[model samples]
Target: MAAQAEPSLLVDYAPVMLWQAGPDRARSFFNQPWLDFTGRPLEAELGFGWMEGMHPEDRARCEQVCQQGFASRAPFTLDFRLRRNDGEWRWLLETARPLCQDGQFTGFLGSCVDITDMRQAMEERRRALAERELLLAELHHRVKNNAQATTSFLGLQASRATSPEVAAALRGAATRVMLATLVQDRMFRIAENATIDLGAELLATAQAAVDVVGRPGIVIEAEMEPGLLLPVSQATPLALIVNELVVNAARHAFADRPAGTIRLALRRPAPGLGELMVADDGVGLPEAQRRNTPQGCLGLHLVPRLARQAHASLRLDVDGGTKATLRFACG
Candidate 1:
């Protein structure tokens, strides 16, 4: 038996194989000259002695699998860490096949190969994606700020124009620009992606409209329910409609008044419906100009157009001052 085992060492295959007689009775043997690498006799280097070369975290698991393989007469495949010749712990892919005979339980044979680099690369990719999303959010904030500055400049130009035709046209352009700006401005403040708080945007719009006049005596009162909050989809037309109605009141409704009061209110009148009213305590619409004059008829006609755009019905009451009420779908 010694002569046969010695000759097997020269076969150019692994000369040592690990085996177990029972659960805790594992052993390793090498043919002929191969035994010198261990620097110990076969008996001392078997069973629990192998723990010195196996990582502490891996030893218990490896012993468990070996015991299970012997009891079940099945193959064992697992992954674990091992101490290498360089004193470093390396990850290994371990596999063991049972060597049963005639349906009786037998030990398992196993080998291992190294996958640490692959796991580290996947972790790096995850971090890179997180950083990219952070950069995109910052870019959106900067772009919003720049757009608001441009809209403010346009408002200033409209305020300075001397011609009525030029001024009215400029005001219209400025109002549209501001409506667009308010969508993003309120969205940023509220931290929503595309929706805005209608109540907040409405207040801001009224304030922005008042800022155009630069007069102190103008008292603008807004009675709004918290329900004024709407998404940008609904806020856009509502804001523009409010803008036009207020502009008309400031420019024409208070033409001969000593004291002026403009009242604005927004509320939900019924399910799925919203109501808005703008009224001023300036001079009421002159009966002749309200119906006949083209120059004075622009605001009245345009208010309906804007209301129609938002699917709203416009009603005008000229009893004391111009009161334009609009009711429409919440969408």
Candidate 2:
């Protein structure tokens, strides 16, 4: 191995600014980088002179942390703004530790790292996040108002319909729209964290659909596994798919029956994957309808497209009744 470089020479020319202060809390040494950073000579920065370059706002806090460290003879870290040689203020993160010789307290040694760019980037990120939250809140408020207005208009139209079937159809449409709006409101409630518990949302959507479409004798129930945490992107399409499925089952599956049962289930069956099943114990799908899929039904039409958006596979089981199972990525 080659000879070790001089320790003092390395400290004097290190990339970061380094300094030392005596036990009296009076700075006694300044490395070349520290002097070059301030564009000042060693004598000009010795003792309490180095603090002259620090921002006025930071001086008191810096003094307090430094004084506390000095009094306790412990290592400490602090952040402050200091003036550069170019007269620009930059953030400096200072870390200092007590120095000892022969187990006896001697002085304090410290290093300063320029973190101005990092701090600025972090501040910009925080600002952008706040703006996004405000926009989402406004969107949620507008959607809620629009849903209520549309539901009321549809209700009025249903009341004017001469036929009960037409009135029921209009009410179902209103329910679907309101379901979307309500789910969005819930999503925005937790949007600040950019995550959603998808299972819970599915259960809520299923229950709401039954409340809207159920008659006196109809029963709609849901079995949902909680803690299916997923991103916001997954929430929208999945919620849409579930809402459409439930609404479809309630309207068409039980179209002829005075009362029936619709069951909804959600589970995280495997890692990075979620499974959702909507089954109705009512009239099964017609052979042609099951074979060709419902081209005329808007809800069924949207189901396949929504499944694709959610990156989920759709399987229809029309054994005794209509059962739609969807498996999608949760990660």
Candidate 3:
């Protein structure tokens, strides 16, 4: 059999070492670099002597894999902790291939590379990502609480207003602010690992709207398909649109009715499209406001613009009663 020196191989590789057993079961040849790295003389590192430097927990597995390679004449690779000269446990990736002569296994050659830095870096990154998510959740919670306080203040001011028009305007403003706060709260509440589920979001928005307008005479009903999830970007606009439509229905549609129902439904309109419809069995929209009113209400203007941003469409069904339909891109 022809023998090759460790440093003479052509391929670029990390530092390597070689050991061959003699007839007396002692190392016959030990590489120069291995002696320098271990800071030990050839006598102390031969056979099973190297186990003294490996982490005690890893020594058994390392020895077992090395033995398998020696007996089977196959390549082997393993990752383990090894104690450095300074008594620190460093991670290492070790690989080896068996040596043979005349089709009989003789010894093995191997290489070791330090992976301590890489492992530490990965751990640090994981901790930083976890911290960032915690901070974001706390910030969203505080912002939602502040918004609720502002809505309460607005409601108090509306109650004290002398003019009916001023009270109505203040109430409208408070409703809009509440809608924005509810959207933020929903986004933060159901997010799993920083992603919002669109289906759950829509369902939550429907529930929140009903809660806000808790009128005893007006019955709120919602029908939605399961397993639809929207990312935060798409969910925000859809929630606000639903909020405006539902609030409008509760305020104006059933203003004079004894028994009324407001239905809010979400369904798939087409591929990559999510559709919502809000209809009430009360007074219909005025023809002038639906067709020719130059300066539309803020809610009307905002809902249509939001639908457009979603690459969706909006329409008001004024034939029988007030029904607002919205179609938007979910993809």
Candidate 4:
């Protein structure tokens, strides 16, 4: 008969480390490449002896996974650290599938590849992401502090101004700046996904604007739809628009009354559209001002500009006090 080649020769020269484990979940065979990589003799690596080269922390888990996979006769993959010939621990990715002959499960055929470099790169990338998040949070904190300082300085300047018009202008500027700061603070505090809760943001901004005005008799109530979320880009402009309208209501709407109520409502009135209504039960706007003209107070001028920026329609109703309606497409 012709000389017969050894069955092991087929896989001994393969690039990956090939192995086989018997049905008992103990290693039965280690190819030449595997044995050479571990620098161990066949007698020393057969059966469960190969586990000695696995990291101590990973050995138990690896054995448990292998046992489960063997019991189920299914393919499985795992990663672990193994000692190489040079005594250095290297990461390895091992994948194994059930072996069967004549429809009877016999053992597990497995292959392992050195993945130390890939694991190191992934770890570095994770560290870089963590560092970036930390830096962004710190930057937001500094911005908030600077905004607060600037608001305080503006308040001081407003207090010292001799003319009422100049003082009012300074106060308005300070309030606008504070509104921007509130938006930034809220953005930084939210998750990295960058979705803003419209109701919460509007409530906070309205409350802050009310507090700044310090009107004891005037009550500002917000009736917003729950869980209205918008991206940062939309939220910022929408917040500024609401801030202007709310402040306008507090200042001009209830001038003659000792006590009044300002109701701010935000709702999704239609699909892909949002509406905001600022209504007050105080003095209504004058006929000329109600016409949405650019020739009016700072709030009137600002409302139109902000509405334009947000792609919203601005309408003023003077029938029952002053109601400002802003409808915009949300899509």
Candidate 5:
């Protein structure tokens, strides 16, 4: 007589649903958990009857995958919605492997776990992330608009100033505010990570500063890599430093010359290092300032402070014209 199957050999009392199939893809056994979950008896779940409880949208693909796995006699996994005993649909993760006995292929064994709650939780997290990104973008937009409005107010104040020196100082302040505003604007347009394209932002801000100055013969040129990215923390200080250097050049560098060219260039000279240069073909810095004292030039004094904030070294050279260089850690 054939040996009786051990109780442990059967999955009938297991918590999870389990099944066995014959070599011809005919159901041979369904554990108690499987029958209870589907609310079906042994006869109703035989052969292809189990497919009746699968969601219609998942049936075709599930069958195709099953056929492929069976043909290859390899372990496989699939996810689909199955109708529960309470008439509710729940997601399930089903895994199956070829079963062998007596050194020969006999059939397949499969197990399934309900993953409806996990799947729903994952979907909720995804939606929440998307909503947070949208809200952040909107906040950046509003901040940028407010900053630009402040810049305009400063411009009006500068226009009404009686002294040329006071007017220039107010205009410089307006440009500084605009620098931060530009950064916010770029952040709003980019992805959720809040990284700004350093080169592009610099080029745009330089052009805007020049336009605000309204110097008839001064031209701004940019030579920058296409997509040099920097986080806002680094970009803001670096941008302010550049704003100061460019404005300083436009104001004093070309005082005696009829026309001048101010060039802004960004280069990666070494790994983890970046170089930003502003060079102008105009009268060089005053002899006293070239000595690095920067007496009476408020913007020039602010340069060192801004460079320190960006963790960069600032250098000024007067060969041919003034060239301001800022070297910082980029990576």
Candidate 6:
């Protein structure tokens, strides 16, 4: 048995500021909340008096929007700065709809909510995001320079080495340095996307396998699931394994062939396990040396160590062509 509230009472005490305009496109009424917010009498706020509180910079655009809506008898929404009772400028999001009486257009009704806090919060987030991107760019540049310098020094040492074995070892070390740098670059490019899943950085390295190996006749076929994520701590070692396998295939698989294909793939075959495989269709490994490391190929000798570092088991196959698989915990 609560008394029913009157329509005028409800409108006057509504949470949002409300207003009305007549068929003549002049402001006809403003509720008590609107008067309280602007510290103006109802008489003073009627017929464009409310416009006096709008920010000068937004006046023309806001007026134009209202005028357009009035002309078409349509609903309209706008955001603009309006002066508060204490003279502080505050953002307001206002929406209006045409009012009809007995199928005839009579006026418009509008409501507004203060949005100053939301506007300021959004601006702060934008500034923070811009600063983060700037820092990441600088980091990527510095990392690239340092890694390139190291690789250059290693190459120089390999060129100056006296023994064939020493030179090959130095060259292999330089190749490792280069591949590690490439993995870091790919990691940097994997954005914590606002749209899709995060961190499948291995996909970038897999797609560019042939280019990274610098083998003229090698074409890499990269197949990767879009959302396969890897642990950052193990990413570089996993990348090195793939890099070494591709390098071996490019060098030994194609002896006299002008073109060959290297199929590189990374997939989560089980709930908590991942697989990275590299296979090439060229010369198969000799049966006698298939079980052991290929003779004189210093790079393949280190694949087992790299696999251990990644906490992965290495599997070698010599069917039709050489296939290398690394199984790891990458859930």
Candidate closest to the true structure, highest TM-score: 2
Ranking by lDDT: 2, 5, 4, 6, 3, 1
RMSD of each: 14.4, 2.6, 6.4, 5.8, 5.9, 5.5
**Compared to the true structure, candidate 1 yields what TM-score?**
0.47
Which lDDT tens digits does candidate 2 get at residues 1-331? 9998898899987989999999988899988899889998999899899889999999999999999999999999999999999999999999999999999899899999999999999999999988987887888788799899999999899999999989988887787788878777776667544888787778777777667765656676778887888777777788888788877887777878788888888888889888988888988877766842567677887888888888889888888888989898876
Model 6, 257: alpha-carbon shift in Å? 8.9
Q: Write the per-residue lDDT of candidate 5 for residues 1-331, one digit (tens) a residue.
A: 9987777555777778998998888888888899999998889999989989999999989989999988999998999999999999999999999999998888899999999999999999999998998888788778878888988998999999999989988888887777657655654566645777799888877877677667878888888976677877788778777777777788788888767999999989988898999899988877878844376677788888878888988898999999889899986
Backbone collision tally, model 5: 0
Model with the higher TM-score, candidate 1 or 4: 4
Distance from true location, Cα of 125 in model 1, Å: 20
Backbone clashes in model 2, listed as residue pairs: none
Which residue window of length 10 is worst by lDDT in model 6?
Answer: 192-201
lDDT of all the models against the reference?
0.64, 0.85, 0.72, 0.84, 0.84, 0.80
Model 2, position 212, has a per-residue lDDT of: 70
- When 3 and 5 are scored with TM-score, the better candidate is 5
Q: For candidate 1, lDDT tens digit of each residue in 1-331?
A: 5556553444325533333444334645333322243345556656557556667777788778767776777777776675555566656666667655687545555544554565567779878867866785687677767666766776687789888788777666655555556544554444333555566667677667766755456788988878555665556667776766676677667677645788988889888888888888888787765532224555565666666666878787777787878888774
- Cα lDDT tens digits, model 3, 1-331, are 8876565342223265455553333455556555656677778788767667778788779778766666666788998886666677878887766666798666665667778899999999989978988998788878878888989989999999999999988888888899778786766665443445555666677667767767667777778766566666667787787787777777777778756888878788778777788788878776666842214577766777777666667888776677888776665
Model 4 C-alpha lDDT versus the unseen true structure: 0.84
Q: Backbone collision count in every prediction?
A: 3, 0, 4, 0, 0, 0
Q: Where does model 3 exceed 4 Å of error?
A: 1-80, 83-90, 93-121, 192-197, 291-295, 308-311
> What stretches of model 1 exceed 4 Å from their correct place?
1-195, 286-300
TM-score of each: 0.47, 0.88, 0.67, 0.70, 0.68, 0.73
Misplaced by over 4 Å in model 5 are 1-46, 52-78, 83-90, 93-121, 194-197, 220-237, 284-311, 317-320
